[model samples]
Target: MKNKTVAAWLAFVGGPLGLHRFYLHGMGDTLGWALPIPTALGLYGIQRVQQFGQDDQLSWVLIPLLGFTIAACALVAILYGLRQPQQWNARFNPQASADAPAGLTNWFTITAIAAALMVGAAVLMASLAYSFQHYFEYQIELAREISQ
Candidate 1:
């Protein structure tokens, strides 16, 4: 049976790698395969920043894909952790009874949820802030050039 805690932890810790999806939906899950693409591009973006400096426009776009993907995964973890046992079992452990131990919420699940929430929110906010800050700065530079 797919344990709720395991899923939650995986989503939070390895969501960018799609580990949770693999655990719950098996290796053939298309989404599981797709999740890493953006993550890889995002890592590439980080590499670009290091190599070319932060002013590389491509990095600005690519880096946020990583952050958003991570945030989304964290959200999935929180959702999994908060699910009622019946609902969780009904969806992920349909072959098992509702009261299956794997479906039950425990302190570990709560901890995963809390960690996901905190980390997700921070990453999301940072990404938005980074994107918007650079956008406004770019706009200002363009305006200055146009005025000149």
Candidate 2:
């Protein structure tokens, strides 16, 4: 049976890598397989930033993919953590009894929820800020050129 605490922590820490998805959904999950694409692109974006610097347009677009993916996973984790034992069992462990210990929320789950919230919010905000800042700066440059 899938354990709630483990799933929550996995989603918070390894969500970008799709570890939590794999744990809950198994290897055949297509979306689980797809999770790494944005993560890789984001990593590549970081590499681009390091190599070409932050002014690189492609990196500006790519970096946020990673952040958004991470934030999404964190959101997923929060959702999992908040689920009632009955609901969690009904969904993820249908074969098990309604009161299965696997579905119970505990300190670990709460910690995972708190951590996911903190990190996800920060990453999401940072991504939005980065994208907007670059986009507006680019627009400003274009305006200046036109005004010249």
Candidate 3:
């Protein structure tokens, strides 16, 4: 397959897994994938604690199910990328060598832009999660009242 075909497939299938990072041979890119592992575990733990306290043992079943589903998806992405690295290299300019910017200002601009985007995304997700949790508690309370 052409490099572009492989790259497209990787983006389609391996995006969430950081497979693209592994494909680029940049382990640092795996940070996006690695960071989520703990988040997944924490989510499951929270769900488990909530279910147990509510005496709804069945909800715990979803913990393992959701965990396995996410893990499977990530694994599939990683495997697909590893299997198609040749395509990835071809699709992207793998030959380009990284060189320091000739000017200090150029380097600063690039770094600043990248950092700003990352921070923005992180803040957005954190706010969304906080809101979701708050609303979820309200939903649970409403359900309890209706049932009572």
Candidate 4:
């Protein structure tokens, strides 16, 4: 197994913003630029949900649910990129092909993570929503039985 570098870890944890790709290409300045969108959207989404009177809900819970989904995807991309032998092996052996094509590791990994997260979130939301709706219906039925 090849030893991993900070760049590899970053890429495996934040590749959706192409940070790993940038770092691999010697563009280290782009490393931290990958966070603004999701961060802003997360804050904005939570605030919007709060304004709708569901303040009882956790602030973090309203983050479009997509933010976590996106972060998870970024993590996967970084992991995928980290898995490529060429990326790590070449780290120690700089004379190795410095310009070979980056594999689908970034794309596929991120996409798969995003898809799975979205599906999971959707299912959870649906289940909770259904339970809440059923609970209200049950309460109404009980009230009618008691009144009758």
Best by lDDT: 1
TM-score-superior candidate, 2 or 4: 2
lDDT of 1 by residue, 1-148 (tens): 9999999999999999999999999999999999999999999999999999979999999999999999999999999999999999999999999999999999999999999999999999998998998889889999999999
Report lDDT per candidate.
Answer: 0.96, 0.95, 0.45, 0.51
For candidate 2, lDDT tens digit of each residue in 1-148?
9999999999999999989989999999888899999999999999999999878999999999999999999999999999999999999999999999999999999999999999999999999999999999999999999999
Give the true-structure RMSD of model 2.
0.7
- What's model 3's TM-score? 0.31
lDDT of 3 at 35: 41
What ordering of candidates by lDDT runs from best to worst? 1, 2, 4, 3
lDDT of 3 by residue, 27-87 (tens): 6665646745644654665576675763444434334433443444444333333433343
Task: Pull out the clashing pairs in model 3.
Answer: 3-91
Per-residue alpha-carbon lDDT of candidate 4 for residues 17-55, written as tens digits (9 for 90 to 100): 556555555555553465546656656666766686443
TM-score against truth, every candidate? 0.98, 0.98, 0.31, 0.36
Model 2 lDDT, residue 16, Cα: 93
**Each model's Cα RMSD:** 0.6, 0.7, 12.3, 9.8
Clashing pairs in 1: none
Worst 10 residues of 3 by lDDT: 96-105
Identify the runs in model 4 with alpha carbons over 4 angstroms from their true place: 1-3, 11-21, 26-35, 55-62, 65-69, 72-78, 81-84, 87-94, 97-148
On the 0 to 100 scale, the lDDT of residue 53 in model 1 is 95
